[model samples]
Target: MINLHGINCPEWVSIGGDQRRFDDSGKPVDPSTADRAERVLATFVRLSSKVSA
Candidate 1:
């Protein structure tokens, strides 16, 4: 996990079909699922920061 501001963002997030994983940098373990993973890690950090603020 990567700590952003005060949130503990997960290093890998399971998303979309088959629950493909995406790293904290938004890189998918399987390149084929890249489109599905998106930048969810960044999104979480952004949203969490807003909530905490």
Candidate 2:
């Protein structure tokens, strides 16, 4: 996990059994997929922080 402005960002994400994705830099193998995943992760972090706060 990585600390991003107090948000704990995962190094990698697992989609399902034996289907782990993302690299050590937290980027998906495919550029398009990475972009989408980044957006989703950012939204999740934003919402989760708001909820916790």
Candidate 3:
């Protein structure tokens, strides 16, 4: 069995965030972005289909 024995992760929910900004290193960061839901749903569909079929 795949054991997730010692992972520390809080439950995630939809939330708002400030506008995306770049830091000193020019790395884009979103303090509170919620745009990942579509990506998550797509991945779930793909994985579920593979496992079920």
Candidate 4:
């Protein structure tokens, strides 16, 4: 499992066939599928901030 909290995943990949989201432990998280894109963008922003710092 990828340590998203540690490395900062920049993409919100589809976990289930219905565009669901899951955490490293295979649990249902982020109930809003529509927010996936924004979530991924947020991660990229955080990663960029860390990289630029």
TM of each candidate vs. truth: 0.37, 0.48, 0.40, 0.40
List the pairs of residues colliding in candidate 2: none
Q: Which stretches of candidate 3 lie over 4 Å from their true place?
A: 1-34
lDDT (10s digit) by residue, model 4, range 1-53: 35654664648646567556567886556666546656877888888887777
Candidate 1 local lDDT, residue 26: 62
Per-residue accuracy of model 2 over 1-53 as CA lDDT, tens digit each: 23545654444344543334667896566665666667778878777887687
Candidate 4: where are CA atoms >4 Å away? 1-33
Q: Which model, 2 or 4, shows the larger TM-score?
A: 2
Model 4 lowest lDDT segment of ten: 1-10
lDDT by residue (tens digit), candidate 3, 1-53: 23853432233335334444547785436533434544555666776676667
Predicted structure with the largest TM-score when compared to the true one:
2
lDDT digits (tens) for residues 1-53 of candidate 1: 23544655555455676546658896677765664345665677777887877
Q: How many residue pairs clash in all the candidates, one count each?
A: 0, 0, 1, 0
The residue pairs in collision within model 3 are 17-32
Model 1 alpha-carbon drift over 4 Å, by segment: 1-28, 32-38
Task: Give the C-alpha lDDT of model 2.
Answer: 0.62
Please identify model 2 stretches exceeding 4 Å from their true place.
1-26
Ranking by lDDT: 4, 2, 1, 3
